[model samples]
Target: MTTQKNTDLPLQGERYISREFFAREWENVWAKTWLIMGRADEIPEAGDFFVEDIGPESILIVRQADTGIRAFYNVCQHRGNRLAVVPDGSMDTFTCSYHGWKWGLDGACLEAQDAEDFTPNPCGHAQLEELRCDVFAGFVWINMDPECASLKTFLGPIWDEWAAYPMEQMTRVQAISVRMPCNWKTVQDNFHETYHVATAHPLGLNSVEDDYRLTAITLYEGGHALGVTQGSIPARRKFGDNPSLGEQIRMELQTWDLNPDDFQGREYETRIALQARKRQLGPERGFSHYNKMSDAQLTDTFHYTVFPNFATSINSDGMLYLRALPHPTDPELCVFDCWFYAAGAENAYTRLLTENGDASRLAGPAPREWRNYGEGTLGVILDGDAVVMADQQRALHSRGYKGSRLAHQERRVQQYHDMIDRYMEGYRPR
Candidate 1:
């Protein structure tokens, strides 16, 4: 029971780069929360979409059928034009360069180009406007308030604490969005901290000893948030840090059996953790989260934020999405998606050696003066956490700064600034 580092909060760190709090956080927090707008396998098919913006809306998302997935408002209710402008394809309808307003693919508004433009069925009284879309856990949430609160009440407990992350049979090798300049709460204050992973990890930073307990700091109620940590098994076993202990015990028994194709093919991960260390027993009956990993901890480090924006890093040498996208009111001009995932069948040789960079930081793991005052090693963990989040967003528009407080181990950054101060205090709950 000892974990504290609020390090003086400063209102969710300067109202996350304010501009009168970014136009009242785009009308009380991105138009009534539940955000996370796309990635249902990136619009699987059937007229797909992928516009996304949500900070004063821009959406689209669509992916009808095969189990619906819709979101609209790329506009076209007729005299509002701007409908789908290729950023991602597939479309059975959606036309309106300036006149031809078609729509469909479940956004309705059938057609309206000529044939008398005054009633008598003007595209059945126009319809192309439905922004509610759901699909949590596989991702694709949206809500421009047509009667908010629902995405399981804005994913209260991170949809069952990420229900054993098979994350919809995981699939996605690269996505990288990028635009970066700053705020989005300075990238969630640099991923809420691993204490800057012994110097901002390029890789090496898992010295696993034990007891780190931070497992619960949720704040769900529209602007949802989550952060948890786990550490235990550490007795000693570092055959050169994770090299093929049966391919890390069949990828932790295929991420707890979402199926790594039944793991009976070949390299049964060092023949099942050397036969579960000769039947050790008891400890959630180890089938493999690297048998409660500890030779440098690797069983549960599950870091997920996703609230108010994004930040994901489910490990196993895979899955890493992290969006920010601010700057319409210039919260400091932002954008950064930084994604990566390499699924089964060695995802084409681990995505061709992560495209030759081999996940560089000079391929991590080297003493390099164990933070001897940091000359290198993850360049002091990405240069002292990007020089303390760019001088804390430049002394938060300094004038000799005034705000600062919150520290009970930064209660998840003050429950993400009291859930963005309960949506800048307007929380339209109807």
Candidate 2:
């Protein structure tokens, strides 16, 4: 059966640069969806907690004494003071720094200073308000909507396809959270389509089969979608015969332990060859997970976008997790998080080479480093995307600008907006 193409959902310029549009999203979209905040194993022990700021709300996700994860609004019950200012730490109980009202890990209000000052005691009855929290794919997920669907339900088919990869045991070796001067949707839209690679990521053609026929796009039951593209081989391009590009492809094959000389004229066959080589040598190299993966999983890239903000690209070698967060106030600004996870890096001797040839032993729940948008390195294609994003944000204000004329391959972008529109119209998961 053929997948139906999405209708062109008009994406207005105001939606990207207007304050009123952002406010609607805060209420209709951000407040109602399950968000993947961090890894569950990050707080393996009791009392270990981390704070995730979503729009104007700050949520405290903590490991309880019973070893289950819980989430609470990061606000003092009394007088609206903030709690847990630090990003992450371990503590027996959270005592409000403002007035010393203390709360246990389970969100029970244990103590309140000046206890006898009130007519009726508030300590025993009062507790920090709890939000729905759950764990899946090794990540701690939380929903502000108390009646929201379970994490597994929210994730739909994504939950099962993702299970093929050993996400639970992977290590986050590289992370960078940067503030960008573009609407959050810009980042999400960029990740949903491969058409841009022909121009935006020229070198990418040397590695991935970017042709539409070779790529399959699936729009799932929920707003979630995935674009699976056959990769680890050179795509047919005008530069296919370029000598320099051929050498680069050959070097990559050699690195994967596949001999470049074996497929000299037929470089496109390297992907299947590498997969066979990986299947033969993977187990000994500590790739315990590859044994469970399919042949496509061993060679191609399966990139998934989880509704409102999160996007992840999974493969046998590594996973790239990206999230676009709305800036608390500005429609023209958002925070973009980039995290790289390597599979089977627990074996110290086996090194995972990152996007820029930075081979390092990968392991984590690693700490994330913050950088200004134009500051530190974000690899090659991503850095280029960052520069264009700000300019894209600026161009959105042009009077001549019309709604996006999307290609069939870019149906996910239109569907994404269609999903957002559904949320705005009061559609919430039951």
Candidate 3:
């Protein structure tokens, strides 16, 4: 999966701060593309549902009686009142708080006020307006456009490449939402390149090789991109006399009964050793999913950018899912979600690498948390990003600032903006 480099693509700063471009993106990109709303496993039983707000539209994803998932506009048929005001819960029927209209789990109009007053009764025939909804990789996805391509078709090679991982079986360990003070694209642009990691997240260099020359980057059709990083290895930038293994990598080796001292001078070989050890002992420890993954999938980190607004960092033990959503009307404001999942036997313990540090916790569904940008910490690295994003948004408005001057390593960022232009020009996925 490769694309021709278009060096002429313009990444003007105006796109980040202009209201006009923001409106165009909503109509041409957000409305037409398939979006991840929530996890399917979150709503396991009948009548369980979750509400997701994308821009100004509110979507209701519910698990139906027949064990299928369905999605509908959160608006009521009578007065246009939002049927489900809360984020999530289980309810046999959605009753409108304003007009007392009731809708069944299958979207049928179960009851309506003044049924006999109207010439034709709306109670039995009227139904809630529905959107196209489907489940992929354990996620509930919805599209506003009725004629959009199927999720499987839009995903292309990513669908097949990710099939080996037991993503559906993994348990979500952390869920967080933050109100950011920058354009949604700012977040996407940051993840499209690792050039900033060396400066903004220097701590990560201890275990991750941040050199672009060594990173394997692949560009796919429809703006999807992937960056594979070598794990358990120190960056070449570090200088020392037999620099020891990173604290995280040393702990990982100790977990599998391997001594870090054995790999003293051959730090790069730790990844392969870890993979071999995990393969030999995984099934016995209940990580049967390891048998399905490849050698690269076992020890390396694959960071995948899913087109317009989603990115996920997949590892052998867990995954980190991130999303950037446009604000309702402000081009400079957006919502960012960070979620972490761990794969193992139910009730098993796993160590998750976070900005705070490596923390051990039982793997399972965790509660969702919401906060403003400065209210709490998204950990060290993300907190640093959050601070810089606001400054970048403000700097883009400077008259002296020209369009982006990208390096070869930042081609993914250019590719992303180019795809946005294609969509604005009415390029639809087949």
Candidate 4:
């Protein structure tokens, strides 16, 4: 499939606030599309598993003794009781707390109480309902629809391009989920375009090129989009003497023993210099993953949006994985998850930027944490985005708000919503 022209589907505000629209999405979009569960490395050992709650369903993904991963609906077949209640754990078999029905790691029913009493014994025949599961770019993906396309097919060209990064070798250093008072799409639309960066995240302009004209935006087939921008440089038109070398860039240059002052009038050259330095010193510094990446990959920010509800900003040595998940019932509420991964020596101290452009240091793998909006920071930039989402959710309800008047740079947003319409109209990818 090739990338299509801009879609003319109306982006009415009702889609963001209507219960009917949200219900349609659950049935037509969320239930059919491939979704990211978590990283494969999270469950390395046999029997290790994690539970991801998406929409109204709970999916249990486990690493089998055979070194393959499998996913199943976290429900007991006998009485429809949830099999795995907690987030994750390791066990020889999944024993249903309600009926003591034992299911093996492969999802086959091992034992059902008084099974012989029934017409046919469930032990040998019964099985947990399974979902299509696949691993790509180190992420465990699950699809609810039995007829859904393969993950590679659904991802299109993104599959091959992402192979250059050793994401599987990276370790997740930070995981945070926040409950937001807004529709899930509200969060997605925000990331689809950088047009709001100048106003919503002014501080980010110091380190990123936010000009839509300068950024390379590619809208791909299957609703995936990519935005590439020069990093470590100010977005301003003029590069005057003593150009701003934001704290992050200053610290980065210092790490390479490059004097920040020397790049005063030549700030635009910093990114190229930094890329060369990293390429030269990466392997010795234990960042061998850099060798597989191109110079642009070493310095530019490659922001990708996977159809439906996932976005990631990938840097040379780190990445910010973001997801906007729908609430179980409310059309006006959603869950936002932010995870940061870094490629370096195991347990090595590394500093990476969060989705909100804040530099965060990690010693090793970090545990997932939950927070409500306003309870704490999602990072300075993200906190601002959260506020905008909430406000947009409210504004979308007003009579004055007719529909979205999108800019050329926001074409990704248009394509995303158009894809949603296609799904709602029963269009499935072959």
RMSD of 4: 3.5
TM-score (C-alpha, index-matched) for candidate 1: 0.32
Question: TM-score of model 3 relative to the true fold?
Answer: 0.94
TM-score, cand. 4: 0.94
RMSDs, each prediction?
18.6, 3.8, 3.4, 3.5
- CA lDDT of every candidate: 0.55, 0.81, 0.84, 0.84
Candidate 2 lDDT over residue span 113-174, tens digit each:
88888556767877898999999988899989877888888888888888788888877777
Best by lDDT: 4
Sorted on lDDT, best first, the list reads 4, 3, 2, 1
Which residue segments of model 3 deviate by more than 4 Å? 1-7, 239-242, 345-349, 353-363
Where model 4 places Cα greater than 4 Å from the true spot, the runs are 1-6, 237-242, 345-349, 352-364
Q: Residues 282-383, candidate 3, lDDT per residue (tens digit)?
A: 779777888888887877789999988999888877788889999999999999887777774432124534433334433447777898889887766677
Taking the tens digit of each residue's C-alpha lDDT, what string does model 4 give over 272-346? 898898899878877777788899998788999998999999887767889999999998999999887887443
